[model samples]
Target: MNRDDGPLFGGRAWLPALLIVPMFLGFAFLGVQGGTVIGTLTLAAVVVWAIRANPEGPIEIAAPGEGVRGGVLVVLLAPIDDPPVAGVLAAITDPSRREAGEPLLLAPTRIGRLDRFFGDIEAARFESQRVLAVSVATLAAAGIEVEGRVGDDDVVLAAEDTLRTYAATEVVVFAPGEDDDGAIAKLERRLGIPLRRID
Candidate 1:
């Protein structure tokens, strides 16, 4: 879900109510047989719409051509100090060819379910900022320049949002562990651009 669209049914609370009101009206006016049919059909429609609007679904991204010189977008899934930063640096900068500009480091806010429900994301944002700070400082100390920004809670959504403004030829994800194979595969299929994962 793009931030602009808000959370599922966030601002558009009226939509579900609108669909539900007709069912009760049918129950009051029509016979049980007719009301049951209407209610079932309405429920089915809602289910279909929800599935279609799912944020986990693949997003459309432009593929960069091979050997193109462009910016790199680095997504940091965990805070890194030194050891992991070396791997991240290796993934973003190729010894064979020079990249276009400073890599953009994005850290997604990882909020808990309860925090998200209550719209209290300050802690999550702070954590993400800290991740970016540590990663950026580590990279800088290693003599590599980077730009950092906090992203959306969902990694895919964060990457998609970054790509809108950053002309990235490749994307590098710094996952905490090798267990993120499923997420890496999903990103590879959806991002379209070249992707490298460092765990």
Candidate 2:
């Protein structure tokens, strides 16, 4: 963010309540009483769990204490705001090309089938697919492996969950544009694991 933007946003604390008001009002005003009560309670509980579970800043994980040969280095590539799954696919196929060879693992974190179908139409899909295909032919050119998955409640939360599950030693990231700090901060908090932001 530009230094001139000041504190970025105000009332960061009440922001959730403000956003949820519409949902609350809509449920209450257009009631089917029993269903509304159950749904509202469920929504509120999830919101609380999600917020309480995330971290809140940029992370810088230390190098692994174990031998490099035995350690597992993971990179959680967040989805592109522009919605091109290919970079993700390509990155997963080979992340070592980036910043001193960060042993890339393309984390699958995206919407359901509807989004994937729509994705096939994007030009980025072609570019990513092209890069992915070529990268396969030239695995010796760069050592990278990619695997995909979907249905991470939140990519950040899912990434964090994976980290703990895998006991990852270090994490690498592909940040979207220049100064996308808020999104970065949200991930840091959600994952609670520090990360190194890669270009």
Off by over 4 Å in 2: 1-104, 112-140, 144-153, 178-181, 190-193
The residue-level lDDT of candidate 1 at 57 comes to 46
Which regions of candidate 1 fall more than 4 Å away from where they truly are?
1-40, 52-70, 87-91, 94-100, 178-181
How much lDDT does candidate 2 score?
0.45
**Per-residue lDDT tens digits of candidate 1, residues 3-92?**
445445655756666887878888889978878989999999878877776555445443445543247788888877865566557555
Model 1 error, position 110 (Å): 0.9
Model 1 per-residue lDDT at 178: 70
lDDT of each: 0.75, 0.45
Cα lDDT tens digits for candidate 2, 59-129: 33334445432123333344333323334434543445433233434343434467567754344344444
Cα deviation at 187, candidate 2, in Å, is 2.4
